[model samples]
Target: MFDSRHIQTFAEVVRTGSYAATARDLGYTQPAISQQMKALERAAGTPLFVRAGRGLRLTDAGQVLARHATGILSTIATAHGQLKAITRLESGRVRVCAFPAANATLLPATVARVAASHPGIRVELLEEEPPDSLRALREGRCDLALAFSAGHGGDAAEADGDSDEGLVEMPLLDDPLMVLLPADHALAGSSRAELGELEQERWIAGCRHCRGHFVAACAEAGFAPDIAFATDDNLAVQELVAAGAGIALVPGMTLPLLRHTGLVARPLAPAVGRRVSAFVLEGHETAPVTALLLRTLSEAAADMERAASGFPRSEA
Candidate 1:
């Protein structure tokens, strides 16, 4: 009989590309990881890995076994979560990671809804850039990650490259992109702002990803912007816009937070939006707390959109 623990160790080694790294992640020594792999190979009477240049590559048999191991481990995890939820011990910890703007706006409501629904479940929030949030989900540091990317005109183009294995993404909401300007600015009274009209004004760029997104949107309208301020902090970007430092492309969900003495948000004329998405490492979907949290987040986002449009939302 194959030891599930040995199978897990072997899978980790393959996923991490080195026994040393796998050992560090699993809290075992390098020698221990090697011994576990060797023992598994001995039991199966076959070599699982071949030495590559400074690393290891899975043999055909190893590749097959690793895949099976991953699935088996995931199934076990799901079963355990189900059993835990069944006995009314519906308590478990989940970490959520997201970008600053998302953290500032969507997360508070999502957390509130989850807390009301699952009083026993504990959720800890981690602030990270989108790339790091996705990484956290892949590496098991976070159970779920809230990630966002520009809407590809309603097509399902994922925000980042699909490098993380066994991951799934669900679109939560379409947050309309808006132009935030000084309250007394000439364009503040306008119902909508065209991308081309802002070409001569100083602009605040959020992060590299955000900058790229804005630049691409402007290119669609025939100009590249002159960035006067660049920051990873969404609040700072809004503060700069409020202080008349420069204008910014702010998301609609963020408008409520930025409603201030010196700022006004106007929808874009061409109507570009970004989709906020929920990510879960696949096979962990049946975890009750995680599932409930995901459902609450999706419903909260829809409620926010409805509220913004002055539509009646059912009681929360």
Candidate 2:
């Protein structure tokens, strides 16, 4: 059996690339670091590191062990945190990744609710796109991921074949993409806009994924948009529209989040929307803090949907 201390020492060596550096970081003598490495090698019956000039390099076996060691260390840290929280639901940390709009709208309210209910739990939020957020969840870097899928499928969790990773996805909302027009634009008087009608107008493209959807949606309408600017910031897109730069297709959820004036948003004739969802590792759902946060997020999503329905419709 390999000691976790030795495994951690090995991982540190791989990261720092030198026994002397590892010793300095871990407060151990260089000889002690060497002793641990040798013991680790003896246990595995292979040389984990090879002398390369003045420094050291991991052998193939060492590289594999280092990879596993990093994961093992992360798991141990997470287990320690959970155990600490289990002792008393008083304190725990939940790492979450979300896209920008969700961060602005959904996460703040949800996090506030979680904080009010469980003052001891700390929620760390990271802004990431859907793919990156899902990757973080799969790699154990985050406990939960707020992600979205458009026309591709229902839930991102169900779309993955890595059941062994034990991911559970819950659908949150169907946030439609809407057309944003300058307040005095010719189409601003309409309740909705067709893609074909805007063929002559300059356009502002969204993020890469959203731009792809815009392109595909426009192609389906038998015309291509004249994209004038490409950006991921919804607020920037709105600002540009207000300045009459170009029209844009923005997610409906962003409407309430935007505080900017002088622009009107109308639903698309054949509404296109993204389905937002929360993804968590299967076993995490049972944790008290995680469960509470999940419930809070659900409540927030419901509230947003209700509020969105009452939002003033664009008119002349």
Candidate 3:
């Protein structure tokens, strides 16, 4: 018989590629991790890993076990979640992760709705970018992930293809990217701003993904923007634009949360946008709390869609 703990240790070691790192993750000593691996090897009657230069490599048998380990772990998580749900959700917790803008706008409303109806169910929020959020979901650290795919031209299928096989993405909304400029700036009075119109302007970008999108849009417009500021905070991006630091391309979902006093936003020509989605592990979507939260999220997204309907769009 194989011990599930040993299986778990094997999977962690395989994932981190270091016994020491796995020990740190599982709160066990390095020697303890080695002992677990040895026990697992004896159960399988074959060596699983080969020592290679100060590191370790999985043998062929180890590779096969690693593949099965993923399924085993996922099944265990599903069972655990279902067991928790058997309490009628009178007392349970759902771990959720999302990017900043969603945390500010969408998630709060969804959480409010959940709290009103299921006060006994706790929803914990972890602020993480899409990559980290997805990682948390796969690693069993988070039950749900509110993530977005930027610069995907609003194609949900394309966005789904980009996610891991262990995750199932449910598209919620298409968030268009808009240009934010100082209220008295040259192009602020216009209902729209073409990418080419900002060729010589200084830019503020939020992240590497946002910067890449901005640079790509500029390239398509036949020029490169001089990016003057970089940050991951959308509110700070708006404040900087309001302060006349530089213009920025921001997602429409963040508009409701912005002060919008000293800045004006216009849609960009040849529009680029992000696809926002609710991601769950492959089989945990049926968990009661997860389902309720997802339903509330869908309702909140509908409200957002209605509110954003009046936003300006480029004429080109």
Candidate 4:
């Protein structure tokens, strides 16, 4: 019920034995210190100070309060410190959900940067496809979700209206889709190729969304893909492509992970790629963890996209 400022002034008065000195030390007028002392005495229901000529002396009540004030002031100072720490991003927890390829590529980089920079902010990652990840975000099981949308003018945020309200998106990177072909394939000699050019080749597709996008892109190019295989496993897809079973379209982020010998990755044109974005509730972007997560995620994806251009040709 008592003001911390008054308690602080009481302790200072007891320390200096003069209201003028307390005021000088605390940047208040002597009259203000005297008034505060009166108020403190009123709150305590007893006189806490007595005039001893040129200085002040403590009454028995004042002695008891001064004794307890030390601990009281210590507790108050500790509380103030904790409150201030909240203003700083010293600690926070962010639950993050990401798509499969993002989990393999961007999540590591994002978590690394977060650990190196904001070590106090804990990051939890969930590996899910865009649909499930976005669903979890809407369901409040996650603080941020990393998702993608197919070629829609390079901005997944607006492209994936996903038919949701109060969900905001931050566009992070555009990961161009790559064509994975066996080295012996007739088109492998070229560094780039068009989606339409491969219309006649047997196709390898992954995840429902990936297959749907590939088929839609093929339709746009005036052809239907002959998808002879459908598997979400990136390695299996690469193995099939390497064995000359069929060609595939995979994200640029997955390009570096392609390990099969005789597999060549070439950028598709008229360029096809997914837009990587961070999704959060409309106002949670300002949260410390979400803001930090968004910043780190953007930086990680940007770095990955920049490095994607330099993918080792010898391995691709």
Candidate 5:
């Protein structure tokens, strides 16, 4: 039987990318970690890692083993929790990563609520873009990831099957695009504005995906928008609009999060909204705590929608 110690050593080496780093982290002598890796290779009857300069690279065989090892170790840790405790509220950790807008809006409330309800569960929140969050979730660096995509209204990348291999995505909410203008703009008091009315106005552009949303929404309305400034930060976009640099089509949820004195938000008459979803690795679904968190987050999103509807109408 392969030793647990050897498996742990291999995992540490793979994570740190160096035997010396692994030794420092694990507080073992460097040679001891190396010997454990050798033992692992011998048991498997194949090379798991290849020497690369002063570090090591996982051989194809090693990559496969590392993947399984990550799952196995996580399972073992969870099993221990299951045997020792009934409620995950007592002690555990949930790693969450999402894009900035989510971090600014839904995430803080969700995390704060979770932390308050389950003081024992450590909630580690990270601000990461979709690509990085997806990568982190697949590699076991995060327990859950919040993701967004521009659906029919924009040019969305074809969904890659491998992009969700080990994870199951749950649809959360659809956020429609809303136009943000200077509070004194002629159309700010209107319930909704048609895309064509703003065609000639300079635009404060969103990120690549959101830019697709604005550009496509306008194209559908028979005019191509003139984006004068492109920025990833929604707050910055609102600031630009307040400064009278231009206008922008931002997500509905962003109205509450982006605080700007001179900006007013109004939905487009024919709305375009992006779909947002939460994903958790497949095996984690069985854990009661993970399930609870998912349920709570979904509920929070529903509340956010209601809050969006109640926002005070701004006037020009």
Candidate 6:
């Protein structure tokens, strides 16, 4: 309940000991300085100055306030300086929450980039699916989040399905959904496969939040998927498929982390891509470390997208 401006004026007047001189130093008129002193005294509930012979002298309360004012102003200046350093990327931390696929692919690229380019910045990562990540972001537990939803590189509203009500969304990856199969499977030799063609096959579902979309896709193709296995682990899904347990439909973004030689990923014939995007609380999009991480993710996704252009399948 103390006004910083009034404190500053009081401190300046204390130092100068002359109303006219304090006004001249601070670029205010003499009467303005006099008014500020009166207002400051009223707020403090005590007389601060009195005439002693021909000069102004501080009352006991004035001396106490003057001592505290110096410390308050110093703390304020230090806070401003640290904020400026963050703006320059000299020191800061960005808290991130993202799904497993993004953690494996995009998150690492951002971490390495920040380490190499701005050593002062720290990236703290948490693994969660889209729903939990959005909840964490909305609650301010995380500064930024990476999520994927059913879409084909569409606009934010379309990709988000209008569910994200009050966050800033940035589209990162337009990764086509692909089916993973054993290398020797009959459809493995095909350039593209249709969901209806694999309707009778046992299915291994991918990420938890994305399972609903996959089920809907299968139903739209006129058959309900016989999901024999479910897991959020991309590698496990690939391993199950490679062992001929079941085929899995996965986002192309995850294919980069796969290393099993027995599996092949192919594009769906109708071509619907899973949309990966970044989200931040509305006003935090421009925060220095967060903005840097987003840019790094965008660039890394662009690289993966370009590689996928060489083949319709995500060939790792």
- RMSD after CA superposition, every candidate: 15.5, 13.4, 16.4, 4.8, 14.0, 3.5
TM-score of 5: 0.69
User: Tens digit of lDDT per residue, candidate 1, span 1-316?
Assistant: 7888898888888889999899999999999999999999998889999999889999998988987897888887889787777445367677898877778878889888777766777889998777678888887889998877774322222345646467778788888888888878898878888888888989998776667788888888888889999987667876798788999887777766654566777888889888788889898766777787788888888888887786211110
Q: Report the lDDT tens digits of candidate 2 across residue range 133-218.
A: 88889888888999888773334444443332567888889898889898898988888998788999999997766677678788
Model 5 RMSD to the real structure?
14.0
Model 3 TM-score (2 dp) = 0.68
lDDT of 1 at 27: 100
The pairs that clash in candidate 3 are none
**lDDT, candidate 6, 184-243, per-residue tens:** 889888998998899889999866567778887887789999999999887788789888
lDDT of 5 by residue, 229-303 (tens): 999977678778888999888877777776678777888777768877888888887676777779878988988
Best by lDDT: 2
Give the Cα error of residue 305 in candidate 6, in Å. Answer: 1.3
TM-score of each: 0.68, 0.69, 0.68, 0.73, 0.69, 0.84
Error of 4 at 148 (Å): 0.8
Give lDDT for model 6. 0.83
lDDT tens digits, residue span 35-153, model 3: 99999999999999999998899999999999899899889888888777655776678899998889998999898988898888899999887677787787888999987776632
Candidate 3's displacement at residue 117, Å, is 1.2
Question: Looking at model 6, which ten-residue stretch has the lowest summed lDDT?
Answer: 151-160
Residue clash pairs of candidate 4: none
List the candidate 5 regions with Cα displacement exceeding 4 Å.
1-83, 153-165
lDDT of 4 by residue, 125-185 (tens): 8877776788889888998988888763323334345554778889899878888888888
Best by TM-score: 6
- Residue clash pairs of candidate 2: none
lDDT of each: 0.79, 0.85, 0.83, 0.84, 0.79, 0.83
Candidate 1's C-alpha runs over 4 A off are: 1-89, 151-161, 311-316
Preferred candidate (TM-score higher): 2 or 4:
4
RMSD of 3: 16.4
Task: Quote the positional error of residue 316 for candidate 5 in Å.
Answer: 12
